[model samples]
Target chain A: MRTEGATVAFLDIEKVVFTYPGRAPVVDGVDWRMQAGEFHCLLGRSGCGKTTLLKLAAGLLKPQSGRIVLRGGELAAPGPQVGFMFQAPTLLDWLSALDNVLLPVSLQRRPTPQDAQRALRLLDQLGLASHAQHHPRQLSGGQQSRVALARALVLEPPLLLLDEPFAALDAITRAELQDDLLRTCRERGTTVLFVTHDINEAVYLGDRIALMHGGRIVENWTITLPAPRMQAMRHGPAFNDYCARVRAAMDGAGT
Target chain B: MNPTPMQARLLAAALFLVLLGLWELVVRQWGLSALVLPAPSAVAQALWSGLASGYFWPHVRATLQALFLGLAAGSIVGLLAGMALAESELLERVLKPYVVVSQVVPKLALAPLFVLWFGFGMLPTVLITALICFFPLMENTLTGLRQTDAQRLQLFRMLGATRLQTLLRLKLPMGLPPSLRGCAWPWCWRWSASSWPSSWVRAKAWAPWSSPPRA
Candidate 1:
């Protein structure tokens, strides 16, 4: 693979390896890189270590070997510059939508007037400004996910990590959030490393899809489809070709 | 079924009236001595006089003082103990047996011992009240603290919250309502009565005086 220093590549993962205590290595020597403002997806079956790799990249898990560099600096503990959205909404049920979005700010104990204004603006952008006072229980699954997304993005982190965030939503809601997430990330020029098992979703959302099998990345394909991809892209030749390649890669690896 | 406040009050009043009428009828029909079984009217008169003479205030005050003191002490100790146990498994293992034994021992039996150790006045009463009050607060607070959602804890850790921050912001808040409920109002009332000596003043002062005047 050619190593080009593009202005876009924000994260570099070189020969990363991880193994749980008393267990075999879940992620063994994976080399992956993504550009700045890129939406990359890790696609695989369950237990393929896609989630584990995402955690490693987010600094939630330390790699036993190799290194992950974020903007040229070694990734350490999760900081304000990196936002993580878990599989669950992970919203504090007692807190209002606005308060949930402000949690990281409160934890850091550094919310300026501008930060508050930014939070409000982000909620507004996410279509949750009117539901600021509502609790997580009051919102639908889609709305809750949106609020979670708003919370994740409110801090304006350069790197956003999503772990199967929309896996729990219904089909229609998932599709809607997919589009919303794509638009939001693109507008902010945020680099997103998303993990999902859905092949269609991987192609639909990811600018580059990396297929993982047995804790290793066997294929990394970059999608060159046009910007603002529509649902019709799924029926196009490019989308079909990417899907076929990824499927073959997965099957070839006996995943 | 949940009764409305008005319905509950009406039911209580009807029960009180029925009990009073039955007592009155039994005493009248049996021609019992006033000393043995005072008429409902006589008891009411005595009660009124006791109230009017301001004899009940001092006892009420003493009882309330004991109750408040015991409640404050018990709640503080219980909360601290519960939090400590929740935070440390070694401490929990060492103390769990003693806590169970203390809770099981009859409080009334221990009352005299408390009096013997602490002496008369409000100390024994407050100690007894605290003993009675501690169990619920400890149990409830401990349960609440332990019942914290694991996912929430993980989320807090992921958000870079320290252990103390997680406890204070998440576990403690989650446990508060149950802890408050555990310290029921009835326990407060009992503690008040035990701690305050005022409730006994009217009974003790008037009992001797109620006998027929010397010839």
Candidate 2:
């Protein structure tokens, strides 16, 4: 993908602080920003508040201090512009794949003929067209995750937040989904803020990677690698170097 | 081809007849009196004549009417009470004690009160049945609703569903199986009410020396 005109800021997080009651801040004094059409990954250990940061951006949680602005609008609550894929697929087990994909629009009371077509197109794009009539329990884990991805994207949201979306899958399925997600997000120009603990995944998919520890972003690295990233890239020197740097940063932060 | 449940039931019935024949032979050899123990054949004759003459139909219909009306009223009230209690902690706290007390109180004692209130017709019978039926339905529905997966609830919130929408779409669907199970027992109770009284009288006739009339 070309990098031209992708420098415009799409989301800005400024001096955000959040804490559970009677506890230390889970996200403390964090400042971060993402550019339009960029694939960013928040890499951190468990309980490091990477998911908390994603929740804040998704407007699922409010920061006690500082501001979160999305597309120049202040993030207040969940809206149609932002989509979220939780760690679990969270597909309604009773709903068929097609209905699950159409849930965001249906919940918003905006499902029209165009929205139905869009849902079908999304299922096809995710290679799930044939399974549209199947329930979530009848689908494999990989298929369920794909359906969830379709649900998140069917509304044509500009911003997508994924909280360890592939953490439950096997390595082979995870790799396949990682590549599919990268290609799809790149083609759609969707600004993705994804959370993951895997260093290799952060390096493979992130255009810019942020390492978070103890509720703060300790390091941020931008990958200047060419698009159409392949598995062979993992063996390349630049990818290895980036992984090593991220690992060192994680170790230094004692996370 | 799969054997139909009806075929299975017929096979069970044949086995039951064989057992009944052996019991009749043993009783005849011991010279059991007709008043003390009417044979299975006699009972069958009574049942058939009762059916052919339509003498049982009115009683059967009356009992069924009471059972069905009671079931419907009990289920609806139980479902609404469970949902309302689920929505408000204060209501649960204030009304839970009364619900528990009602379950613990014997229905035989409560039956007279219902008869006094509604009089000696279907109303008293239906009211008694409903009182007997409500506890299981309410408890099961409440448990099912309260136990909905928290992760799923969070997903609904993230999807921007209102609280009512979440309850209707997610929680209600999840509670359906348990609620249906709770509703099943009223059917069994209906059948028992038809058969148990006659069966108890038959047993008493076989034990003739038990007790004389008090007055």
Candidate 3:
């Protein structure tokens, strides 16, 4: 949370490049940055490397070239300062919901009563108070995703990297989760790098959308939509216009 | 219609009695020797005499001792070796061949070599039993650890979990059920091994005892 200067970016990715073994570069030399409390979405088609870029930002993967710095410090590996959400809920089935939420704290040492209390509070905040004692199989997919969201927020991490966390949910559930995510993240002022292929989702959730093509940022847009983004805004002309532009840009990039 | 629990129990008991009666009648009619096929009554008489004369106690003690001791030793060692093998790939690569060879050579063949080293007594037999129980548990533990969900592992990595923490909190707990199954499957093998050692020990001594089988 400490800042070296007023001009220092919260999260900075500088000319990072990565490739899997025996494959072409998935994330070809890319440079990007996010300011404190900014919501940025990386939008791309399948296999275009948006997820790989997010992983690089989270320090889950090392770049073949260049560097990534968080809070003006070089990112070497995954640390508690950043929270990550995978495409699937990825909850441990053997543990109860509350125990799973407290896993991050419990990993280093025994969870103090305060940690348990905090985890319970997070579950309650996510409307999962009653289901705190349930195992993953006992909960619905949407509920599981909510728990995963709470886990990502439990450390009160300054930066969050999410890889299409709601892609599997029904439309209504997805909308509700998006609202919950926006409200919680805005209140905490967490800088988020969300990866998704959905242009509408990017337009709806992000303050800025970065269109990625072939492992590079092809276009970037600053959403000027009114604050407290409402469900009604999705039908507005301004929202439709932004979605249309992003779609066209994606099409052009694909070609 | 399906029978109730009590009826099912009674039916099983009645069926057992009928089978026993048929066996007794066939043996008596054929004038078969007890050495070949003992009748139910002959078996009961021997059991009663063994208990009344107190001839069965030491044999029973020896057998029980071997059974419990072998299972305890084998299961514990197997579980630990499994944990070790699962934790380090280098350790697995360095030692896996020997582990496989130990299992590959039949225990029956190894019994004599154990006798040569430990002498004709309970120790060699227990060693063989322990060796018999080792492979399944180790294999199961390795499999369970390896089979952990990739996404969950990624989640752990993202949460800043150390290697030890991941093993204790995630891998070990996940591997336990399979490890227990390893214990269960070898139970029948344990019983056979219990009786097997005494005969195997006698055969090694070249002095076959004429005593009836101890139950």
Model 1, span A31-98: residue lDDT tens: 98888888999999999999999889888889999999898789888778888898999887766788
Of 2 and 3, the candidate ahead on DockQ is: 3
Range of the 10 consecutive residues with the lowest summed lDDT in candidate 1 chain B: B186-195
What local distance difference test score does each model get? 0.84, 0.85, 0.87
Residue ranges of candidate 2 with Cα displaced over 4 Å: A1-8, B1-38, B178-215
Per-residue C-alpha lDDT of model 2 across residues B1-215, encoded as one tens digit per residue? 87799999998999998999987887788888878887788788999999999999999999999999998888888888888887788999999999998788898798888888988899989987887788788887788789788878877778788777666667766676744532543332233322457646756888877757665
Ranking by TM-score: 3, 2, 1
Q: Using DockQ, give the best candidate's number.
A: 3
How far residue B90's Cα lies from its native spot in candidate 3, in Å, is: 2.8
lDDT of 2 by residue, A1-255 (tens): 226986536898999999999999999999988888889999999999999999998888999999898877788888778888989898877678987888777666645799888888888888888999998889999999999999889877899999999999999999989988887788899999999999999999998999999999988999987888998899899999999999999999993
Compute the lDDT of residue A179 as modeled in candidate 3: 93
What is every candidate's alpha-carbon RMSD to the true fold?
A: 12.4, 14.0, 11.6
A best-first ranking of the candidates according to their DockQ comes to: 3, 2, 1
For candidate 1, lDDT tens digit of each residue in B79-154? 8888888988899999989999988899999987887898888999898888788888887778888988876776
For all the predictions, what are the DockQ values? 0.16, 0.16, 0.25
> Residue by residue across A25-97, what tens digits does model 3's lDDT show?
9999898989999999999999899999998999999999999989889998998899999999998776779
Number of backbone collisions per candidate: 13, 0, 0
* Candidate 1 ranges with C-alpha deviation above 4 Å: A1-9, A252-255, B1-46, B178-215
